[model samples]
Target: MNRTYLTNIDTSISDVDFTQHKNAVFILHDQLNLDTWPSWIREEKPLLIFIESAAKGKTLPYHKKKLVYLLSSMRHFAIECAEAGFPVYYHSTKQHYDRALKDILSQYEDLHFTFMTPSEWDSRERLRTVISEFSTKVEEIPNNFFLADAEEYKERVKDGWLMEYFYREMRRKTGYLMDGEQPEGGEWNYDEQNREKLPKDHSVPSIAETETDEITREVIEMVEKWYSGHFGESEDFTYAVTRRQALYRLNEFIDERLDEFGPYEDAMAQGKYDLFHSQLSVYLNNGLILPKEACDKAEEAYKNGNARLNSVEGFIRQIIGWREYIRVYYEAMMPEVREANHFDFTNKIPEMYWSGETKMNCMSECLKPVIEQGYSHHIPRLMVLSNFSNLTETDPRELNRWFHLAYVDAYEWVVLPNVLGMSTFADGGVLASKPYVSSGNYINKMSDYCKHCDYKISKKTGEDACPFNYLYWNFIDKQRETFSKNGRANFMVNMFDKKSNEDKKAIFESSADFLEEISRYKKEQ
Candidate 1:
């Protein structure tokens, strides 16, 4: 199993004269866009180097489907580069990246390596270590995969660190959904018009499945053989591996799902995993589709009257506003952000998260898609999955790793800010204003999950009560001082204060017992 899968096919040159072709471009798994190639690379057609480290793929017990998606995509891109008349040296190896690069360096003389700055912090550090050793041969450029300007973010964020301010600044800068100096439709955000629950009569568009070609089939077989006990199933692996397929999915989303995407963007339901949400994050996070291109297509849909402004604006906000802002936020808050634990919750993760077996209907429903397909829309992620974690005081770091391991779209840059900052409030109000914990009533209002649950949503205390009800109050009472400073969350603190002494005691006891139960469940597992 430690055997490496390495291949090198130089289409342009058969000879191995490293001094003749001194310039080379190295492609990472995430930076797969051909159009983003530098002018020198396009003109000179320098040697293309791709390293597929199996050791890197198994760094976190990554979902088997994620493994297939990433490795397949890399292989497909390598073929594309070969067809495009570039000499490719593709390395599929179980060896560490540094050692692999060292071997490559040993074989070549006066060969220089240029790569796009890696998206993840650890990847950057590893590259830095290699660059330090080969100072004359290796260099990197700023990653253009994202559209946010760090300088603009710093200038706009002087007033506050909120996303809205940064989002508006990006709107003005990009002129996306903008009319002259003001926002299109006289509004900056259409989120208020969104957030409607899924109606019974409403139908969801079917998610487009990518057909497995020979390369993907080979990858699935390799991943199954290599990663047997990883997270999610790889049997039904069907994700767009090439740029053409990713664009097709984007167009399909715009044509069928974009119009209704605004209203039901946050809605979740039983048996409906996608619900009007454009599952383009997988494409966006990887380099299959650029942010500007996707945003432009959505804007065109709005202009042509094919999609509503609310839907288009909402989709654009996710790209330019939240996604880009989070990238910048991650850059600003790393090393420290990784270890940020404000409430310092030391509890271990529950068994139910991995097994997807739980009496809680909402948690089970949300965790199902993640375990089966390595996907779930944003609402389920923020409300149900991370909500349960925060309520149970699970370590935010463990939950972050689970998100990275469980979701195909998860990268450290996106997952860390979201899990530690937004979801769990582990950064002490740096990424999110407050903890995103909520009772079962919110879940009931959003979806029909509570109506069929074992624990009564109406009950606020006792053994049969929904655990979220007591856990929310317990979190509020424990973090009263933090909530009191937060103007928006202060009302929840007042409500918890108004609870009678007996009710307070019942809430504390229920939360305590439930926490113990999950902890014991973890121990048993």
Candidate 2:
């Protein structure tokens, strides 16, 4: 079945004049909503351009659900724009941005394009060059979608590159929890109290899921038919795709999940899937909800004494601090950051990563969520998926690619710094001070998944021993000289140095055996 699903609406190019259609507003799939539209954007009443770019689809063979989410959301937004008295030119084709824009320019003469600057470096650069060729005025608006603007980030980051420092700067700049010159609660960080594992009796709040309307159903069918072999499941596509739904989810998160969001923010458990983590990254990454708005809401809750300061501070840090910091980092070091592989790891990704078939319960559990829903909170991403990749010396590029393909919210700028820098330490401490490596003990402490696992968390060696235990030592030994330079990693390196040479040898052997077994499994698959 070689069929293509392209969105074609009524519009003609024959003898088109620029007098009537000179002004055009091009919207990317990620920039689905018009909430941040400038007065000029609304005043000009430009043609709303919604492109279902096939170049985007071919970029990574993204998950079917992700495809459905973006396309459905775009379709919905187009309908809204039409209802709002804007001429909507919706088109889908098997062409990249450059080609698509060229086609559009050909159809409509003397046209000027107004677009919110693309979030990705490549797209932004390409669009700039494309519009330059026409010699027409291209109004590239500043993206006010984020809380911290580019100028603000540049000024604050002049002091330091550390995330905590940047976070504090953001806190002060935003006045999120400032009492004049002091932080609220007299503490900069509340992560100390936010590390508890879930109590057995604790219950998770229900997710405020968006109902799939008719347009979304069409997209699902389109993706299921066209992207049949893409990464994730498409059947249960229930993500918030509009502004109304995203706001509802945000409010629900504050009312029900924000209190418990601080404590147990890092905790992972079996069948607890998302636990108390607010799954707004999907909405936030897209244009549905702005960071400042979300952070302001959390702060408002704390001011009203509705939520605790710890929870409020922690939640604000995620939105205004870490999320914004990563974007700044991505802009500072890209093109090079994309190719950064400090360890020069060349190992192939195991077949199990895609299949979600593994003996290790931690990896299995983590990968299963990604496979089923294209989501898993930050813990599993850093502690489990990237930890395993770092320990096994899996290629950072491969890990990064998998992340972009597998997750719904993944954009280039967001995914690169996280995967290449924080996750793999591939930039040699540009984004992370030290590698986020942990043994079975950390995973066991955080979750009950280890309790029912095939491997024993207590064991240090042998087939029954958890792979993470030996793999952690193997990575430390392998990168001993490199990691020994970092102050934070020195303690772990010193502990590994004190271990008996015999135990060290056994750890290396087990790691080797496991890697060989994984290779065999790869061949079998």
- Candidates in order have lDDT scores of 0.85, 0.82
Q: Per-residue alpha-carbon lDDT of model 2 for 1-525, expressed as tens digits? A: 122443322311122234678788888877765767788767777777777776668678688788888887777777777777787777777777767877778766778788888889878887787768765656777775776676656544433478898888888888999999899889998999999999886888879667887777878888887678678899888898778888999999999899889998999988778888888899888888888779889989988888888888889998888999988888778677789898999887777778899888888999998888899999999999999988888989888988998898899989998998888988888778888888888999998889879999999988899999999988888898777898878778899999999999899899999988785113321
lDDT of 1 by residue, 288-312 (tens): 9999999999999999999999999
lDDT of 1 at 440: 88
lDDT at residue 359 of model 1 (Cα atoms): 89
Q: Name the top TM-score candidate.
A: 1
> What is every candidate's alpha-carbon RMSD to the true fold?
2.4, 3.0
Off by over 4 Å in 1: 1-20, 151-160, 519-525
